[model samples]
Target: MGFLGFLRRSRHERTGYELYGAAVAAARDPYFYTGLGVPDTLDGRFDLVGLHAFLVIRRLQGLPEPGPALAQALFDAMFNDMDVNLREMGVGDLAVGKKVRAMWEAFHGRAAAYQAAMKAGDSGALAAALERNVWRGTPAGAAAAELARIALAQDTHLARQDLATLARGAVAFLPAARAVA
Candidate 1:
């Protein structure tokens, strides 16, 4: 690519990283772990990140042109972070790719489930999917429903945001603490 093309690509990558960072921050909210009863383990954290990423990506998919590109960047940014995290956690070099691929499949499946549930306006389906994935098919009391509510709220909030703002990597998630109430 030429200079301008390289610059544009770099800018998109930077925005993708920023957006992914926002999703991670939202996923790490104390309310989700402490107040809502989400497990505090690594897998739990991954599920939360996947949830937040799905919210952003779902909205991005509906826009024109640069929307798809930005969505791809966001996906790339997320997997890149996962790859780095796995390495940091001392996964062997060869194992990292396999692990990342498994994670990729998990994220895709979860995202698809979420998209379908929300599109059909089936909160119960969303909750069930959350329970199965987030709670590992174990009982979670009201936590799964609460999480479903929060995810719906965040999705609505994201849907209203302008593409331009999102393209600039300026995305905001509704506070999970308030969503629980």
Candidate 2:
């Protein structure tokens, strides 16, 4: 790759990082924990991030050429951040890769389940998956239902957003209060 190619690639990676940051911000909204009863633990946080990231990836998949490439960049950005986070948390160097790999598999599993449920327009299925993963099968159906609703709303909102703006790494998620309401 030439200088321009390198610059172009870096630009996409930066955009991906920006987009991932936005997803993390959305996931950190207090409404999820206080209002919806999602646990305020590391696994819960990871689940929220994975959920939001999956939503963005799903939207990106529906776009054209650059869409797929951007989606790959986004995925790469997410895992890279996870790796950094593990190291920062004092996970040993040798264990970090294994931990990250487990997280990667977990993310893919949850994403697939969510995608299938959403594609079928089955809120119950979505809630079931959320309850299982986010609540660890502790029977949080009502809370999971609320989360499922928010996820559906987010998906609809993202679908209508201008693709060009999203491609530039600017995403606006629905307001937490409004979404939870």
Badly placed stretches (over 4 Å) of model 2 are 1-11
Backbone clash pairs for candidate 1 read none
Provide the clash count, candidate 1. 0
- Model 1, residue 98: what's the lDDT? 100
lDDT of 1 by residue, 1-181 (tens): 6767866564489888988999999999999989878899999999999999989998999999688788888999999999999999999999999999999999999999998999999999999999999988988768898899999999988989989999999999989988646
- Give residue 74's lDDT in candidate 1 (0 to 100): 91
lDDT of each: 0.91, 0.91
Question: Which digits, one per residue and each the tens of the lDDT, describe model 2 over residues 1-181?
Answer: 7767776565579878988998999999999999888999999999999999999999998999677777778899999999999999999999999999999999999999999999999999999999999998998978899899999999999999777988889998997769756
Going through the candidates in the order shown, the clash numbers are 0, 0
- Candidate 1 lDDT at 15 equals 82
TM-score of 1: 0.93
